[model samples]
Target: MGALAGLAPIFGAIGTGISVLGTIQAGREAKAQADYQAKVQEMQADEAQAASQRDAAATYRQGRLIASQQRAAVAGAGGDLTDPSVIDIMADTDFETDLAARTDIYRGEQQARGLNDAAVNSRISGKNAQKAAFISAAGNLFSGVSNMYSRFGAQAKTTATASGSTRPLYG
Candidate 1:
């Protein structure tokens, strides 16, 4: 029993160390998960920008094709390409096509901006997780020390009382 009692502190210390390590490991995993999420968000942002560019290019191509077809149609119908009304129609088509393409680009940019914000948020979350883990580990260490003192301190008090000693057994 005395031998076991002497080993109690060693066992407690080992337990405390394991607990602190586990807490720190959990925190690291959380940070890692957040980092992975941030990476995914960054990739998504890149894809959003690329998709926007592709959409804008397609819009421009379609607009050019429509304009060309309209011009061909006018020529086939014996219409004068230099007439004021014909020129106005072509201009309107060009304007509308440009507006639509620009709108697509704007929409895409907004989406990419949102995704980038999410990525930043994820990275912040990761940092917070890491900080929290360190705090938890410190708390575990303190708790373990307190537990050890309480257990040993109580035993000292008990022994002092049994011996009818007026002096406190421990400071």
Candidate 2:
């Protein structure tokens, strides 16, 4: 489905290129073939429109077929999934029984996938949070250390002055 969706742009580009080429040729040769030139331009526009529609139709059909195949594959993969084999059993088995069983299995699979996604997301989220906390704490610790150094220098100056020791003021 995705691949077919992507081809729409490619088809658009091809049509645009063809239309430009047609316009250039029609302009250069209009004096010699006035009547034919009009017809040629009209035909070119119609042709491009038809080509784009046809390509879009083809892409839509291809996508539908692929989706159907995926659904069929899912149905067939499980023995109890309303599959061909299950239908034979359903001839004798209750419809609700078969349906509920299949639903339960599909639900379990979905739950498992959800849990796995949650675990991965939680781990990544926690790691980022811890990293941010560590960075914040480191910044705070650095600031505290800087303050302590300044206070220590002030205390040393006061002690030197009390002891009458001469120290260079500018060194």
For residue 101, model 1's alpha carbon misses the true position, in angstroms, by: 1.2
The whole-model C-alpha lDDT of candidate 2 against the native structure comes to 0.52
Query: lDDT (CA) for every model shown?
Result: 0.90, 0.52
Q: Deviation in angstroms for 169 in model 1?
A: 26
**Structural similarity to truth (TM-score) of each candidate:** 0.89, 0.33
The lowest-lDDT stretch of 10 consecutive residues in candidate 2 is: 28-37
Clashing pairs in 2: none
Q: Please provide, for model 2 over 1-171, each residue's C-alpha lDDT reduced to its tens digit, 9 standing for 90 to 100.
A: 989656754655455455545544444343334334444545554554555455555555555565456557656775345567655544434444444445545554555455455545545554554555455555545554554445444664577555555888896
State the weakest 10-residue window (summed lDDT) of model 1.
156-165
Error of 1 at 36 (Å): 1.2
Output candidate 1 Cα RMSD. 5.1
